[model samples]
Target: MLQRASNANQYFTHWVTAAPESRELLALCLRKLRGLNKVRIIDASFVWTEPHSKRIKVRVTVQQEAFEGAIIQQSFEVEYVVASQQCPDCAKSYTANVWRASVQVRQKVPHKRTFLYLEQLMLKHSAHKETINIKEVKDGLDFFFAQRNHAEKFVDFLSSVTPVRVKKSQALISMDIHTSTKSYKFTYSCELVPICKDDLVCLPIKLAKQIGSIFPLALCHRIGTSINLLDPNTLQTADLPSNTYWRAPFASLANATELVEFVVLDIEPLGEQSGRFFLAEATVARASDMGVNDNTYFCRTHLGAVLHPGDSVMGYHLTGTNFNDPQFQELENSSTYSSRIPDVLLVKKFYARKKKPKRNWRLKRMAKDEGELLPKKADQDRMDADYEMFLRDVEEDVEMRNTLALYKAENKKEADAMSMTETDLDDDDEVPKISMDELLEDFEDLQVGE
Candidate 1:
């Protein structure tokens, strides 16, 4: 009887806040109200004493709490007591620093290309839906969540896309001694390996041999659950798992920023094939040294089918460039590995730059808080350069496009008018064009959010 009285008191206190409109609906709502126990409601009727009265008189018929199966009837009057109050969740949103969990993502690289790629992956998978706030810090982006589970899910998503190491910690926020209940703030420090696609990685000799007998110098072909490294000389590829990578961490000797433009003077197929790449010997000259010096270099590359006499390409000038890495030092000091290093390592074939280039496809970006302090001019320039390079990568690489969601441009007539020049450019087979079938029509404008 005490428990029944307690449940009835709790239920009726909030009943007037959501009273049903019609008499039948009110009776049905009363029947479903959570209070009655050891008693089954058979019928409920409501009577208004006055036409516009604020009180409702109700009679409920229920089964008695006994094996004899007696029927009992009760009548009660419910009065309206309306007051304005804020719910806990709504109040919490209005306050600051109330997040229970946070994930700090950091990459020690100089450029933001990696973050751009990560953002695209997050968008493709809809991984940031649960985040309450995303803030851009000094080195990386921070994701804030209301719960620890959401932060853990974000950490898992980061682990699946790139090679990252995570450290977890929690701080006691508040404690209740009477009930022995406590509140804690959780934080996850996630650090990504400072290597990106097309980066020239000088692997540790021992680690290189353990994963695959590929050369110590390799190119980061792609990043997924593991670091995919490809030997430019032999076209041999190896996947460095996240666990194995953390066991012996290594940094890149050079990244795409150090790439030098070279014009292909001559190329010949060596009749060797590996997937989409083919072995060939190419004679290239530095674009800067084209007219100033007649110096040309003969090096072997994997892009045999794509290279032509007049095509320009980008590669690392490894001949006289000094690297301060331990692995590079080891390779330099050892006679066995010294001869295997190439003078110029070709990264990718270059394309003609348009005077005014416009894309008919667009990528969705996450609305992130970049913090209050504005970035320095140099830092902003570097970020713009990285984003531009990433955009070019998406346009040139079909495999990359497959992993991202591309929406058709909002301006159809402008896109159609620009298509003519694109068609003309595609005729030379130098520029890559994304098929219209691959683009998704954006209907975001039609959506009405609640």
Candidate 2:
């Protein structure tokens, strides 16, 4: 429904097709009323069609009573069509159309003078007969009247009308600005470790292969136990711990000593089968010997290690010992390592897949075994039983439905004659009619060239 204001206190209503409980229509009405700051609602009502119509009609009327004793009245009528389908067995139909109607009145008024009057009322209503200071009273009067355009006259009148008391105290006036563009910022961080043979960290070959499969972007850097002795002055390099051991076949690159920490840059999701993963940047920060026993070794902790400025490593890596048991088995098997590797690089990938879709195989097999199951007269019997129950429930009361139907039939007959007479009267007046095509042409001509 649409409406246009013809004057300050009048409007022309244009009825359009709409749902009774449409949020869009409600929002439009609210926006119109909000824009008219001085308008005060007096009363409102809605009219709606009952069930069983191709289209339900909604009518609403609202009156604004605050415009210089003027009334701004508006009416809207809208139609909505319902969709329905019939049941195959009983031939009974059900509709999906539903609507609700509600009307409310709202008013807006200026409250500056009312607030001042309320303050005065509070002072007058006080039970204690405390003496009010003349200077304080004068200050109060001045402050109250200073808000109005006729400040001098208002202040004089206030002073003559009442006495008041005032007290001085520091009061902070604060204002906060909330903007739509304000947003939240998030921080992300990650750590990277460069591979070293002396680190006493012998990851399972299967684990290495799984890591490679999952994080193809990761580059493994192999270093031997001899690399720790490169600086002979540091005797701390060769002292192996009692419980850890270093593995063999390490790389000879000294440049490997410089890279250490890795950081995550971004993450992206692959398809449902591949899963989501992260891309990261990493660089070496510190080189140190890990303590080793006879067969096992542990990498030493490097303090204050920092990745080089801009080298980004992309791959997934595991941190902390929390692999699932079955996953642990996968890590142990060399064949599995050759097949699919888990990523243990700084860049990580997490895969997600759709669950298996439900299949109606059981139902299909049952149907095939049973052949066709046709609806019997049992449905009619059930309907008869339902009708009997409905009658039993209403047998003792007056038939309101029947009474309404009779009344509507009589009223409809009268309405038909009245409508015919109204049509005759309209025919006598001979209103000028424009063809729809002509109206469309006129509307098109009115459009500005663009």
The lDDT leader among the candidates is: 1
Query: Would you estimate the TM-scores of all the predictions?
Result: 0.75, 0.15
Candidate 1 Cα outliers beyond 4 Å, as residue runs? 1-97, 412-429, 447-450
lDDT of 2 by residue, 168-239 (tens): 222211111233232111111111122222122333344234323232112322112212221101111221
lDDT of 1 by residue, 314-371 (tens): 9999998989999999988778898888899998999886644566567777888878
User: Which TM-score value belongs to model 2?
Assistant: 0.15
What does the lDDT read for residue 419 in candidate 2?
12
Error of 2 at 265 (Å): 44
The C-alpha stretches of model 2 lying farther than 4 A from their native spots are 1-46, 50-56, 65-450
Error of 2 at 125 (Å): 92
- For candidate 2, the lDDT comes to 0.26
